[model samples]
Target: MYQPRKRGYRKDNATLRWSLPDRVFFACGACHILAYAFLERWGTPGMQALWIRPAAGQTGNHVFVDGGDWVFDYHGYANRPQFLAHVWRGARRRWPGWDATLVPLPRDVLISEQKSRGYDGLWLREPGQFLHDAMPRANAYLDRFRAPAVRTAR
Candidate 1:
């Protein structure tokens, strides 16, 4: 299980040895790419990209793919209920007083948010490269679960 790093704790030990993409697994600034990658590859028409943000505090925004029955994030895959519980627990741990809400987002919204952050939008322009760089390390972790991740569109 990937443990969320404590806010402002910047000590690097074994994680330094991991590849840059691997290290970004559950780290900051990764949710967009990770979630986008999964949705692009495996998402069905019924699925939606969700943006989870706390109602208070400085908690960062999180994006994940929600397939009605299941959800996949940087942490891997889980049933909807299980994923919600996990996210709720993490939010409580990190921001004791805040309420976190999951909002369904469109692809354009995600791209706009990324644009606000000054991403050149390489992922949008070059999906092949984006998938090439991001999926391998993610799949390595996700493959541990009983449910296999989709590497390409069916």
Candidate 2:
């Protein structure tokens, strides 16, 4: 019911947008946030932040252990780099080895508006192929993050 106007729309940067009650699925910041939300520090050692995707819906805003549909809902992240930076930073300190890395999607990615049955509304991916696929908009955000850093040489 509360689909606020979209924010962070920039041709050069990525942004996230979702109409609520409609579910959101994302992984952009999961590897970082999940550790605390899922296991509350005891789970830090094995969690890797190399490549994260965040997805969520209204109910998606909690850690799986936090009980709101799998830990703060990665799906809701939608291209807010500063938010992403914060999440990753917290995760980095929690898991110092997680300095982000180049890990391609598990397979060729797919992005779509359709969601599998039982989902409340809107979706970034179906369960089966999620690790390998990304919704069109979500993938756009990923690409923007993965973009090579511009370097200036003296």
Candidate 3:
């Protein structure tokens, strides 16, 4: 199981390293087949955003997170869920607390991808990057809850 990082994902470990994707194995007298899965961060920006948004809104500050997204898989239409879970697992290994929601993209994105080549991707938005965008908005959002931090800290 992946743990939450107090801060955010480490660039060195954005890829999910787990062998299996998010799965739900069942035992009911029946056949067995690899089933589809949809991985979730379990926890998400809501909690962080919850605490910071209020402060940023009140202070009229900007918020942003800085980092790059790891390309786990693209156009692997058959294994979309597994690919995402893999990235999630990899991310967990690097930053246990970085519970950034690896939520599924809209169904339309998937459907379109299946039709052609879709950009099945993981938006590994580092907390630091978010602060970057938020700063201008006066959102005042940053990974550093106490003393504000610079992007180079990571």
Best by lDDT: 1
Whole-model lDDT, model 3: 0.23
Q: Which stretches of model 2 miss by more than 4 angstroms?
A: 1-75, 102-126, 129-154
TM-score for each candidate, following the candidate numbering: 0.60, 0.24, 0.20
lDDT of 3 by residue, 1-154 (tens): 2232324433333232111121210011000100001111111222111000111112111112211221111111224355446545664565564444322233222213242134322122222333232112221111112321223534
State the displacement of the C-alpha of residue 27, model 2, in Å, after optimal TM-score superposition. Answer: 6.4
lDDT of 2 at 21: 18
Clashes of each: 0, 30, 34
- C-alpha root-mean-square deviation, candidate 2: 15.0
Q: lDDT score, residue 41, model 2?
A: 26
Model 1 lDDT per residue over 91-132, tens place = 677667656677776665454434434422222222223324
Candidate 2 structure quality by residue, lDDT tens digits, 64-149: 21221112233432333554466567655655645432222211121222421123332333323333323443334343332222
